[model samples]
Target: MLITIIILAISAIFFVSGKIRSDLVALCALVALLLCHILTPEEALSGFSSSVVIMMIGLFVVGGAIFQTGLAKIISSRILKLAGKSETRLFLLVILATAAIGAFVSNTGTVALMLPIVVSLAMSAGMNPSRLLMPLAFASSMGGMMTLIGTPPNLVIQDTLTAAGYEPLSFFSFLPVGLVCLLVGIIVLMPLSKLFLSGRKKREDDAKSGKSLKQLVNEYGLSHNLFRLLVTETSKLAGSTVIELDIRRKYGLNILEIRRGDLSRHRFLKTIAQKLASPDAVLQANDILYVTGDFNRVKEFADEYAVSILDGHATEETNRNENSLDFYDIGIAEIVLMPTSLLINRTVKEIGFRDKYNVNVLGIRRQRDYLLRDLGDKRVHSGDVLLVQGTWNNIARLGRDGTDWVVLGQPLAEAAKVTLDYKAPVAAAIMLLMIVMMVFDFIPVAPVTSVMIAGILMVLTGCFRNVEAAYKTINWESVVLIAAMLPMSLALEKTGASASISNALVSGLGSYGAFALLAGIYFTTSLLTMFISNTATAVLLAPIALHSAEQLGINPVPFLFAVAVGASMCFASPFSTPPNALVMPAGQYTFMDYVKVGLPLQIIMGIVMVFVLPLLFPF
Candidate 1:
């Protein structure tokens, strides 16, 4: 018992700290259990080939199809359009959509599909996206409570109860409690979002710089009449600097900035050439000059010398309306995609993307946790966020598409891809049908099978373009982690580890009777979930909960429900679930943000489920 406790504790630490990759941690625990004679090698490795694991893989492929087809994107955009411009209404709509989908689809999928739209909506509303994204993540988690197939925890609980000789929970058994929890969560969360989330501040920095320079100009904007010129070797002003040419006095114009290269409209050649030849070096063949505040001065300067006035790419019609048009230089910034982003496992080559939309993917920021070869060519995976770059206009465009990628923050130029056509209603209908099947037991197909079928049908119907594209839609790392952890869960069960520890627990808490025991079960499951994957914790504890019930001579139904609710309510840590991890980068959240919000929510839910579950199920 002591040895088992120690092993489980070590595994728990590894899971909770999230210091190592989850799959690796699970692998190590399985090996250790086997080496210690806790389980045979075959037993240790059995989880990899489990039906659950296979189901997950197929479902992932299907999810990828739905994502690639742009179905989710279409649904999100229409929702936003219907939301009007009200912040309250917009947030509510997002929460509703996210929760509704999350209740039936994968929780990670819920966050991945919704985050881009949330960021876009926040930008359109002139609000900081950081504030909204996290709440959206939290809301996705809350929605996962509604059905058995909503999350792995509920599934674990149902299977555990059935194995323990009790009636498995019906799909909507927890609907009332789940609805109450979801409502309470929204009410508690909305007001705190701004406090925890901040806006993209660099945009303001770019604007400030522009405004400072603009204010110094007498014309307050670029004067079209003044032609900016570059001094070449043939020009009379080629040998002149600011001091030598006395440009301000001679032409009644001040130099705004200097650059080299193309003179295209709005494309500033800010990178000046290096390697000055001499202290008194005459301006070379490519010295750009930005003269401001005077039109005739440009003509006079050009006439006096052989300098070439720069012709902008903007046409004459565009220049005519230039006064009213707000032409801010779209800035470039690097953003890291969070691990929970749906974009993981996808590549630009597959997304039908190119740089025409003003968004450019300059580069990627690969995590040190896992080594990725050929950054651009390598497929994106969970825990591998990206550093993308793009203009605000392009970022907005990408966000509105349903290609299943999340914008981490500001786009790095390399990661921005062209937006594609999305069919929202079709995607929503498919997703809705899958959820309905899971909840109402309508089709009787396995939850994972339903997801896979819907996903394939979406692709066949031209909802998405390619078969491989659909493969990129699932969170493979989470799937792998769940698979690997199953071995550890089995080890825990077979080692007599769970029964020993649970017996001690039951004896220690027997004084409080079944109610206190139920609370302990819920609290333990919830707390463990915050550290380990909820499914792992659920599987490990099911035997223990069942064992405890046998000793207490009461129905295990309430006790089992406690495990399900507890395991699913894992919002307090990033590693607890993918939704938490997904929002971290986009929301710019710290560990404390989750603790501040999730801890209390977990505590309240723990209490509620313990007291209320017994009443609902009867002890």
Candidate 2:
């Protein structure tokens, strides 16, 4: 008992600090339990092959297939267009769209796909990307709250209820409370969000910040280099094509890409400049070109040609040649990395970033509260914003091409038009059917098995263009996290720790009856969700909650519902949900922002579940 207590205490510390990877922490706990003989070796490894584990893998494949096909992008574009461009309109629309789709799909998957588009739209609208990103993330969470198929937590509860001899919940069983919670959450977030959120500056203004780029970079223990050149209307380069631009010969430079309109790059055109049609290809006002060359050459070229270099870099000494720095209405902005970023503890110099990504880390956004200091010398953190300057095209392209990097609502070019395998819809339809069968009891296969089989069928049918893409879609972190944590949960039960904890609660709240039990269950799940993946939290707690029911001599319905609701309330922390993580980069939200909005909502959820669970599954 004492050993189990120590392990539990250690687990709590791991959960709170999140210093080590959660999966590693869970694995360590499992190993400790196995070593102590609290659990058998087989028990320690069983979670790796559990039905939930199997199902998540399959669902991940399906989710991957959908993304590979670009169906999510298609859906997001249509929704945003319909939502109109107003910040408030877009917010509600995104929430509604995400919730509606997420209810039937994977929340994390939904967020990952939609987040890029949301950021793009916010940047286009000249609105702070953060304002809408958080709402969209929250929407994904709420949408999944509605159905058993909506999120893993709901499925866990329904499955546990089934195993305990209770009727499996219907697809919409949780809709009433879920819908209420969703609406209340949105209503509460909108007004309060502005207090912490700031709108991003306009593109024209950002273009004007070019001079300040150097100042920004200097703060990061880095320096910015500026260049100014003219794309004369008569130059063959101007009329011939972007591909034909004599970057290496005339300018002795590298053209990262060009931002013509909102597009990223065009593969068919060979080069970014080539994509512009003959007449329209002429360089017009604000036709900025991002080139990589020496700062001296850039300065000499600008001096000889009489073009403006962004003035943000100029100060007293530099101002002696201030006339040389032309303010061409061009600007640059910096975004900081918060402590949570994977980049934290890693430096741009260490990453071989320039060679690897072909983009310079011009400036650093400090991790501190204000924009006054640059993060140049400071290590990057999760929430740090980077003040980067490159050709608008290079900056945009860099963010998209790199998997490890996320762009903070920077305007970039359009995506290359690639012929998509339209069979994705058919594959998606089939997968949807599988999910429906489980929710409606139209099929006998477990939800996990059904999703896995659907994924296999999707691959077999070529619903996905390639098998490799399908494999890539599975969030391995989530899979590992779930697999690792299950063992520890089982150990807790095997060691009599779960029973001991449940009995303590039962005794303390015995007079309060099931209402008390429900709150404890709900609050515990909610708290866990804040720290770990919702699915992992649900799976880890489900068995324990079920076992606690047996020991307490009560029906497990209330307890199961508690776990269900608890796992869904991840609004309190960015770590609470993948969707949150996806948007946090672009939205520029701080850790405090999530806590401020999510904590209250989470508290309200706790209060509501206490009342709702009793009504839904009379204790």
Candidate 3:
């Protein structure tokens, strides 16, 4: 027991300090437990296969697909429209909308989905995003209180009950408690957020250094040089690969993308496919190619290949207005050459960008001067910002060669924002089906099974761009943290450490009746959550809460609920929850910002839940 307590104490200290990664800290603690012989190998390793962990993983994929397909954004944006320039109204709606979505999505996913939208809306309303961002983070936690799958702590409690031979909670078992949490959060957070978060100056760097796509296009005069060419029936370009044509080398023309239409089984309907122009992409009749080059060179190339120039006067105004260029499959980014770059004096052709980097140098920004055409003979200079275009994956590779050049702005974040809106309907239908399967007991599928089915369906139905994209949605850090920490609970139980802690609690607070004991459990859990992750805290304390309730001759349901609520309601620190930390930088929030706005909310919530749980569960 002493060894177990010492290991847990060291782990808690590291968790609070935040120097080491929490997941790493948990793994070290697991190793200590094994080395101490407090747990067998099977007992220590069981957490990896825990149903709770599996459910969380599946939920991550489901939430990722929902966001990737733009369903969550559409719903939130439409609902936010009702706020209509009223900051107060916007505040209320932010809380309500976040809570509603969070009940279905993980709180981290909920905040991530809503962050950019809320920032955009807050700025449009002429209010600082900070006014709503903190509340947005808090409301996600409150929202998680609404359903069994809403938060990890709720699952921890449910798992505890089932392991103790008690009835497991239903899907909506937390709805009433969740509703209460949402209401309290709304009432308390509105004034607190306004008082503590309003009128903060935006960070100067908040305006990203990278130019927007439209700005880049206009500055480089790309629209004036870009043209569309059609591959007609008699066109020599048909049935030939781009490599066979070697247009870049022979005609100074770059094929940016290819647009093709194919007739579906429903012959009247045509599905349009847009793909990045690769060297091996074979051209066929009726294919429309987006090409960029000098007007005369493009005309000469089209005439030689028997292709028709579809748009003879494709002016900058028309291209900008129509938004002809998209970054779905391919993307563009500007990279500044390092002072010591080996290619500093090399011409574009000499550098062989196409052969080496698989990207095309479309333009160069040398201070105020822009060179859009005749880029092949242009010499690369130090500190020159070259606008390169290629597949998003290839563009990402440029950042890895940091010694040569630095890619500006957040290319990956920009890529993530490109929504697959066409798949929204499919994602919504899959989400609805999963909810139905879980909500209705008449359905034979388990909740975890329903989530797994929904996750796989999301990938199969193309909600995400690819399977790899789907995998990126899961936060492996949080998953591993939970998995590694779960075994600590088993160690505590095996060594009688959990029973001893519960006995101390029962003896200390039992004389004051169950209400005081309830407060003790709630406050202890909440306090611990402020330091470590809420999921880890719940894993450690749940068994103690259960043992305490049993020793007091009371139903463990209320105690378990208290544990869940306390473990989740932590708000006094930004590090307490992922959502809180997520908004800190964007909202320009300081540590005190969270303490001033969140501490009172935390205290009031604990007090309320302490009284409310017993009434609802009838201990």
Candidate 4:
């Protein structure tokens, strides 16, 4: 017991300090328990197989499909249209919309989906996006309180109740609590946000101005380097594969795309098929290759291969014709290098974007200046934003390497705008079916089973672009954190630490009444959550809360509800939740901004839930 207590204490300190990843800290604690023989290997490993972890993973895929198909944005944009010019109305709608989506999706996913829409709407209404964004982040957490699968803490409590042999909560048991939270948030945040978040420099608007495709092309001078070359019957490049030619390596040239004509029975009415250039693509007579390189290199390659240069500047055409850059298969995006990216200080040639990631670096944006020409030998610096063009699949692959760089804005949103919007209805229907299976008792499917089925259906029904895309949606860090921390709760219970803690609480506060005990548990959980993950906090406190109520001879439901509410309601610090951290830069918020705006909301919520929970669920 002493060993377990020491391990828990060390882990808590590390969690609070934030010097290490929370998931790593939790795993180390789990391992210490095993090494101390406090838990068997099977006991320590049980968390990885827990249904709460499985359900969370499945829900991530469901939520990803919702965003990938653009269903969430379509629904959110339509609902926000009602806000129409009233900043107050828009503010109310932002919270409601974010919370509503958050109830069904992960709060992080909810905030990400709603961020741009809220920003655009706030700007249109002449309101600072800062005013709506913080509330937007808060509402996602509030919304997560609405359903069984809404947040990890709710799942922890549900698992705790079931393990104690009590009747488990139904899907909507949290709806009332969530409703109260949303109402309280709407009432409290309006004035607080206006007072604290409204003061921002005029540079805010300029910061939000992300570049468009045409702007990127012009800014990079891609048009100057871009040219069209036609392969003739006599050309050596005809009937050769792109890899066989090795133009990129041998001639310092990149074939960005290819346009070929398909002749119909009426030869004059031939249709052109555009394909993003790939290594395996076969060159044919009359094929139009969209190439980018230095003028001398392009000229030499054209001469060597007997290929004719069709136009020096065919990219200037603005029509939706065969000559323009087609985004159907290929796209361009900006990626900003992290301070620790291995590619930093490495020249473009050494990094080999084409050979390594199958993408072309069109230009680099370093602060105010843009480097467009002779990019081969340019040494990359930290914070350099590179404009890259490739197949959307390849661009998305680049985005997944989060340690090296961050793909700016929403690449999925951009892709959905052109290609995947047709899948929105399918994704919406799958989500509705999952909700139905979870909500209806007669369906005979468990909530976790329903989530798993929905996730598989999301991929099979083409809601996501591919299986890998579905898997990419899951945040492995949070999943592992929750999974690894769950075993600590078992260790506490097995070692009698939970009972000891509960006895101390009961001995200290039980004489005061159930309300005092409830407040103690709620406030303790909330305070711990501000430092560690809410899910981890809930896991550690839930067994203790259960034992406290059992000792008091009152119903344990209200106490457990207190645990969930407290863990989910953490808002005084930006590091408390993923949604809070996500909005910090975009909203131009300082740490004190969260304290000034979020501290009041967090305290008010605790006070309200402490009084309101027992009324809803009797002690």
Give the winner by lDDT: 3
Poorest lDDT segment (10 consecutive residues) of candidate 4: 263-272
Full ranking by TM-score: 3, 4, 1, 2
Kindly indicate the candidate among 1 and 2 with the higher TM-score: 1
The lDDT values for all models are: 0.60, 0.60, 0.81, 0.79
User: Judged by lDDT against the true structure, how good is candidate 2?
Assistant: 0.60
Tens-digit lDDT string for candidate 3 (1-619): 8999899889877765767776788799999989989888999899789866787678778878887877776765675689876777888888888999889777765776577567767766778889988999999999999999899999999999999999999999999999999888988988888788886776664355577776776777766677889999999998999889988778877777887766344332223477667777899999989888888998999899999987575865775433266566677889999898999999998988777778878889999998766788889899999998887788888887557889987677667767766577778788878877765668898777888999999999778778988898887766776777777767766787665664576468866888998898888788767655688778877988888889889999998899999999999876677677667656877667777899999999999999999988978
lDDT tens digits by residue: candidate 2, 352-463: 4445544445445544543322223445656656655444455566556655555654433111111133444655576567757555655676666667677887777655
Maximum-TM-score candidate:
3
Segments in model 2 whose C-alpha atoms lie over 4 Å from true places: 11-19, 101-173, 188-440, 453-466, 512-521, 524-564, 567-598, 611-619
Off by over 4 Å in 1: 1-70, 81-89, 101-141, 147-173, 191-194, 197-416, 422-444, 454-480, 530-560, 574-597, 611-619
Q: Please say which candidate is ahead in lDDT: 3 or 4.
A: 3
Every candidate's CA RMSD: 16.8, 14.5, 6.6, 10.9
Off by over 4 Å in 3: 64-76, 84-91, 101-177, 190-215, 223-255, 261-282, 291-323, 333-361, 364-367, 373-386, 392-430, 460-468, 503-600, 610-619
TM-scores, one per candidate: 0.54, 0.51, 0.69, 0.56
Model 2 TM-score, all chains together: 0.51
Cα lDDT of model 1 overall?
Answer: 0.60
Q: Across residues 493-546, which tens digit of lDDT does each residue of candidate 4 receive? A: 688765566457645876788999899888878876765568777887898889
